[model samples]
Each structure stands twice: as structure tokens, then as C-alpha cells.
Target: MRQKSVLVVGAGLSGAVIARILAIRGVHVCVVEGRNHVAGNCHTVRDQHTGVMVHAYGPHIFHTDDAEVWRFVNRYANFKQFKNQVKAQVGGGVYALPINLHTINQFFGKTFDPNAARAFIQAQTTPVIAPARNFEEQALQTIGRDLYQAFFKGYTEKQWGRAARDLPASLLKRLPLRFDYNDDYFSHRYQGIPEAGYTDMVARMLDHALIEVQLGVRFDRVDARGFDHVFYSGAVDGYFGHSYGRLAYRTLDFETRSYEGDFQGCAVMNYPSADVAYTRITEHKYFAPWESHERTICYTEFSRDCGIGDIPFYPIRLVHEKQMLAKYRDLAAREAGVSFVGRLGTYRYLDMDVTIKEAMQIARTYAKKAGVAALPAALEAAA
Candidate 1:
């Protein structure tokens, strides 16, 4: 019998890491990427017009407390110390996000201490609905209508293209309110951007003698009989012929502009007043603040329902979508010689750290299998 050659569809980080690991162990691997670039949504490139390191898709910040994943990524590329600070413009004033101490003082026209701030916000929130029902109800219960309307309500509506009242309460967790002056977006210990860009990081991972990369190639499984195992990192619903119908997804459209100098004083600014058509404006130069460019590039992000030919960015796991996803998952479970991973495959929003960690776990399972007879166990363990 011929040796089993593994074929991985999608050259994203998840697929790249898996291929890199197997290739290093003397296993033959083939990577098929439909896109010309390797990194999927995390793809970054230098803008020829603005000469800035632009996040081609959108703003992607590497943030996580997982030391193992952080260390693993650093081995291939260097990461700069970048802290995310997000500001929102509401009611003709800009305030720090995540409802920090400074935001409360600015929002209500008063400066209060830590204890006073907590008490003030608590008093502001109404407990009309005993148990919160929808996102609006949860917000009103947590921080009251004033702050909720000013901060979350409009932003959520803009991003999801639905009213807060229609959304589920489970979407809003314990409203993270900081009594201190901390306004950092993420609470992760490790937060930074790859100095050489994410595409470079993926390139470094896939650069191997035993690996054959085929860009602009689609795997149909109709006339393919070479590979021993196949990995699908795309939409699970599409993989199964949309048998359970297409899972709902939210896609993003970026409106770009060239600016002479600093556009927004910061990296990200949210116009959450319901008046602005777009939700947020991201300055690409801010992502790479270390190197200054003569011109700056900014993207006005507009989120909408995923249509045909549109790249699905965020999965909207609503009640109906959840039921459809369950059916798709069952179909995937019964499939052979294939394992699914990543956001689209699993139908979950995953950061870079989680994506890499999942790939690492998949690699371990494959290594333990050792032979063809044990590959099914490896697939089960990976799933």
C-alpha cells in the first residue's frame, strides 16, 4: 500500500499550522488555497496608494492569555507590543469604551470616585424586567436605558442589522464596567500585532520541503484519488452541499480613503449615535504606528447580511442558525477522511490564539494515530 498523503484545504493559519506540523514529521502534505494569498481574513499587505501596512480585511489584533499559543506564533514571527484603545462618539462627545470610569464622568457631566461611580451606575439602571429577556432588556437591567442607548444599543443595531430588542439576552454578558481609568479593549496578557504581517507568519509556517502549495485550486472530491486524508476549513454547510441550508453569516464592506495626516486621533473610533451609516472607522496606520507613513489609510466598516459572492466574516448564531448548524455538524461527524476546523468549519467566532490552539490539538491527535487504521480515532479526537 502507498503511504497516505494529507491534503489540507484553505491556507489560513489553522490549515498552515496543521500542514507545518505534519510535514516536519516526514509526512507528505498538500495545501490548497483558493485565494491567491495564504491568510484568509487576517491577510495584511502594504497599501500601494498610502504606503501603510493595511489590514486588508479589517482590524485584527492578536490578543490572548494562552502562553503556549503566543510562544508558538512568536517562533515564526516577531510581535510588537500593541495595546488596543477604543473610543466611541455618542451624543456629540467622545468617550472611552467598555464603560470605564472616565466614560461615566464624561457621559453624565460629573466626576465620581470608584465607589461613587459604581453606585451611580447601579442607581441609573432600572429593574423593570425582573429577568432580562432580550439584549435591550439585559442592557436596561445592567446599566439602565441611558448608557445602554448611548453605548451599546446603536452599535449593536448597526453591526447586526437588527434591533437590540430582537436579539437574545445571552449575547450580552455581565456588562464589563471598569471603576478604574483602564480603557484597554482586551484584558489579555499577550496583545500585539505581527511585525512582518500575518501573511508573512503563515508563509513561514507553510515553507517546507515536504509541502506542496497549490493556490487557486478547489477540491471537488469527484476526480481526486491521491491524498490519504483531507481537511476542510471552510463553511461546513457548503461542504455538505448546503443540505441543511446556508448558515446565516454577517459580511463586512470596507470603504477606504487616503488622508494627509492623522485622520482620527486614535486607532479605532465608533460612531454609535445611529445617525452614521457606518459603525466604526479604523485607521490602518494605527495598526503599524511604529513606522510613520507620509499618507494614512482608513476604512469605514459597514456590516451587512452575507449575500452571494460575499466573504462571510462573522457567523450569526441565532436560534434558527443554531438548529441548522447542529444538522450540519451531524453530517460532518459521519464524513470520512476529513476533519473540519476554524471559524467557518465549526461555525464559531475564534481569535488567532484559539485557532492556533485548536490546530495544535489536531496535530497531536494525528501524531498519536501513527497509522491508517487509527486515523478515524484521530479525526474523532480532533472534532
Candidate 2:
């Protein structure tokens, strides 16, 4: 009997997990990646000069509340404890991010306890804008104008290349201000980076007899004719040759600098001041604190409008983008023998853990039913 064959597009976490699960279930899988190597954005390589693991695209810290997702990643590679402690570079002073107790006290020059701090911040907020209209208004009503201007206003404008009032109120969905001193960026139960690197971990995930990985190969809809089913993790617009107008995205431009000693004394230092063109500076060596290096590499990240031939990073799912995304999704639903998966496919900003979890679920559903016909929302939503 001929074994069922499946095509997995884009060798990132989503494709890697799906390929592994389906292969384990007795299906033959072919993974094709346009880039010369696998692991897409999460691709990591050791700097020959510094011997430091560099996050080729940007920093990806695996932090998740889901126990299953944590265990799943651990199976591929050993993970080191990595807490993302971020600092913000403002006017003549540095402050802790997420606006915690220390940041509040430092910025205001007041020593207030947690209870007093909460009350003080509450006092600062004015009820001028009821049912806030946009990000700027929502922020002023929640964190007060003083802190909003200092922390969010300029940074938000620089990052999105737009004024705060122009952005959706949903962008600042929750009050980012914290009354406590917990400096950890993410509050998830599991947080860490792979000891070897994400690329190594993903490589292990694709290491199976049933899985065949071909790098530097781009697969189009025509190529789907050779396989029973296709799992595409590439941009939804790219899959259809971008028939509908292109969706808006903010791509990052990194200015890398090599230094003999520590540069910023931290992994990520954000510049909230609009005067500074770049958003943040990330020291790569700090990402893996467990490993020490004499030389360090830092990337000064600049966010701007994504252009042709540029790698899209953040999907700007504003009003216009959302409307355009609907048209692409409608086209995706009509396509046969193919399912769109992952951040680019769904047109949403997704964390690494969520990407892996969704991919695993999709593959498991297919394994249980022994056919793509039984796939879940990841497929049915488009259908």
C-alpha cells in the first residue's frame, strides 16, 4: 500500500511540529523552505568571532502558561532559564519596563508602597474621556497623561510610525502599569531559551525517517498536486501571489555592532523617546546568560513600513489591514487540499508557544482521523 504523503511549507515551529506529529502517525512528510535554512524567524546561529548564539531575526524567548506546550519544546532540546528583564531608556534616566513599583517611584521621585502607589496612580488618572476612543485616550484615562507621555506616547509612535490617537484603543487592551516590583517581562509559568539554540531544537524536530526537509526550495500551489495535503505556514497573501492588495506589516531593520565588553548591561533596552529613531537595543549574549562570552553583539532595532523584498515582522492588524485580511481569508477558504497555519497565515501576532500549540493540535486532529477532512478550526475557519 502506498503511504499517504503530506507537504509542510515553511520550516518554522509551526511546520516543524506539524511535520513531526504527522510523521509519527505513519505519514510521509516533505518540508520545503524558501530560505537556505530552516526555523524561519526563530533561526539562530553562533557568531564565529564572538562564539555567541545570535537570534538571526530577533530575540524569541519561549514563555508559556500551557504545560503541554512547555513539555513539547523540552523534548527537542535542553532549555535554560531565561527571564526577559527589560529596561527603558528615557530622558537622562533608565527605568524598569511594564511600569512597576520601582519605575513609578523613580519617575515620580516618591517612595510609595504598593497600596499607596495604586492609589497615587489612580489619583493621577482623569475621567475626561469616557469610553476612550483611541490608544492615546485610553492610555491617559488608565495610566494618566504624565506616565503615558513618558513611557508610551513617544515609543508607540516610533514603533508603529503613527500618532497614538490614530491607533485602535484595543492596542492598549490592558493596563500595563504594575504596582509591584516584579521586573520579569512575562508572567508565564514556563520561560526559557533553548541551550543549543532554536534552530538546533527545530532541526531535531524535523529529524525523522518519515520527514524529508528540502531547504532553498519554494513551493507554490502548483507543487501541491504531488502531495495529498499541504500545510502552508507562509504569508496568506503570498500563497495566492497576493491577488488582493498586500496586507500592512512593520518590518524591522537591525544595526548590529560588535563590542569587546558588555554594551548595555541587559538583554533589551527600549528607547521610549521619539527623538531616538531606533526603538530598542538588544544585546544578544545576555539572551543566554548561562553561556559567557568575552565579546558581545548588540542589534539596534528600527521599525518601519514593510516594503517589497523586506522580511515582514509585525502584522499591523489595524482597520484597513483587517479588512484586507478578510478578503485573503475568503480566498484561502476556497482553496482545496491546503490549510493555512501560523502567524503569517492567520495574519495575527502570535507568540512561539501559541504557534507550536496550534500546530500540534492540527497535526493531532489529522492523526486521529487519518485524514485532513477532520482538521479543526485552523482549517475550518478558512473553509
Candidate 3:
């Protein structure tokens, strides 16, 4: 009998993880990536000028509550403890992000305790609207007009290129207005950046003998019939030739600048004012605090609607996009010997941990059904 062969599209976290798992399970995996390098959006490279590890696409801080996922990553590369303490530049002043007690007290010029701060914010909140409907309404009702306008209004408009009133309230669900001094962006059990780099970690994951990684190769060029199973991690709309219409997405443009010394003095600093064209500036050196650098590299991030050739970063899952996504999902379900996985495949923004977890789960499911005659059906069902 011929050995089972699998075609894994996009040699990113999703594809690499899945390929690694399947290869370990005695399946031959061929990993193809459109980009010249692996690790997908989390690709990191050393900046020759500054000798800083630049997050090529953008800053990707690995933070997750899943112990298994954390352990899985650590198995391949060492992760340094890094806390994402984001600073926001609003009203010509720096403030701790996530709207903590220090920010509230500093903004209001009061030494209120957690309870007092909570009460004060509640009072400041819009009392007229009992239940908030949209992002704007929710912001007003939760943090009141002053805080919302100063921090969220302009930034959100620039980020999404849409009024906060037009966005769903669910979008701001994780954005917390804390009463304590904790300024850590995420409340995850684990948070760190890989010591070597994301690309190195992914390369290690694809080091198995059964896994063959072919970079700068488009998925469309591959012959799917050659493989018993195909795992696609590219854009779902692109796979179907966008017959239903392109799904809405936001892409980022980075303006990187080199500095002699410490530039921003922080990993990330948000510009929450309409006056600034860029949303935030990231100092790459700060991402790896363990390493000392005489020079620094910073990137001013600009968000815009994803164009035809632009790389899609965030999915704008509005009502119209949702409708189109449903159509694509239906089309994908009908595809034989193919399974859509990862952020682009599912049309949802996924964290690193979740992506790895899902890939591992899918690969395990495929391994379990390796001997079964109805493997394709089981794989499609799992997807």
C-alpha cells in the first residue's frame, strides 16, 4: 500500500503545527507557503542596522492560558518572560493602557480607591442609555464620553476606518476598564516572546524528516490529487476565487525608523487621537528586554482597508462580511479532500495558542482515522 500523503498549505503556525503532528503520526506532509519565509505573519528577522530582532509583519506577543499550547511552543524554542505594558498617547500625555486605576486617577486628578474609582466611572457613564447597542454606545455607557473620546473614538475610527457607532458592541468585550493598577494588556496565565525568533521556532517544528517545506509556492499551483488530504490555511475567499465577493479585511502598513538610542522607551505606544495619522509606534528592542541594544528600531503602524494585493491582517466581520463568509463556508464544505484551518481559512482572528491547539486537534483527529476508509468525510467533519 502507498504511504498516506498530505498537502499542507501556508507554512505558518497552523500549517507547521499540523504538519509536525501528522508527520509524527507516520503521514508524509508537504508544506507550501506563498511567502518566501515560514512563520506567516509572525515572521521575525534580525535588523542588520540596529541588530534588533524585528517583528517583520508586526509585534506578536505570545500570551495564552493553555498550558499544553505553551508547553508545545517551549518544546521547540525558549520563551522569555515579557509583559505587554502598552502606553497610550492621548491629550498630549502618556497613559497606561486598558484604562486602569492609575490612568483614571491621573486623568481625573483624584486619589480614589478601586471602589471609589469604580463608582465614579459608573456615575460618569451615560445614564440615559440603560443598555448599549454598538461600540460607541457601549463605550459611552461604560467609560463615559470624556474617556471614550480621548482614548477610543479617534483610534477606533482610524483602525477600522468606521465610526464606533457602526461597529458591534462585542468588539470591545475584551477591552477592560480596570479599577486596579495592573496595566498588562492580557490577563493570560502565560505571556512571552520566543528567545530566538518566531521563524526559527517554526523552522524547528518543520524539521521532521517526513515534513517537506517548500517556500514561495502558491497553493493553487499544487496538484491536490497527489495527496490523500489537503489542509489549507490561506484566505478562504482566495481559495474559491472570490466568486461570492471578497470578504472585508484590514491591512497594516509599517513605517520603520532607526534611532541611535531608546526611541519610544516601550514596546508599543498607541496614538488615540485623530490628529495622528498612524495608530501606534512599536519599538522592536523593547519586545526582547533581555537583550541590550545601543540602537533601536521603531515602526509606526497605519491601518487601512485591505486592497486586492495587500496582505489581510484583521477580518472586518461586519454584517455584510458575515453574509459573504457564510457563503464561502458553504462552498468550502463541499470541497473534497480539502480542509480549511487557521485564521484566514475560518475567517476569524485567532491567537497563536488557539491556532496551535486547533491544528493539533485536527491532526490528531486525522491520525485516529488514518486506517478508516471514510477518512476524507471524517476530516471534513472535523474541520
Residues forming the 10-long window of minimal summed lDDT in candidate 3: 374-383
Query: Largest TM-score belongs to which candidate?
Result: 3
Q: How well is each residue in 184-266 modelled by candidate 2, as lDDT tens digits?
A: 88888999999999999999999999999999998877889878889999999998888888998999999999999899999
- Which prediction has more favorable TM-score, 1 or 2? 2
User: Whose lDDT is greatest here?
Assistant: 3
RMSD of 2: 4.0
Give the distance in Å from residue 184's predicted Cα in candidate 1 to where it truly belongs: 0.5
Residue 210 lDDT, candidate 3, scale 0-100: 94
After TM-score superposition, the amount by which residue 33's alpha carbon in candidate 2 deviates from its true location, in angstroms, is 0.3
**Model 3: how far is 377 from its true place, Å?**
25
Q: What tens-digit string does per-residue lDDT give for candidate 1 at 155-270?
A: 89988998898888877783477899999888899999999899999998898898889988876765236777777788898888887789989999999998898899788999
lDDT rank order: 3, 2, 1
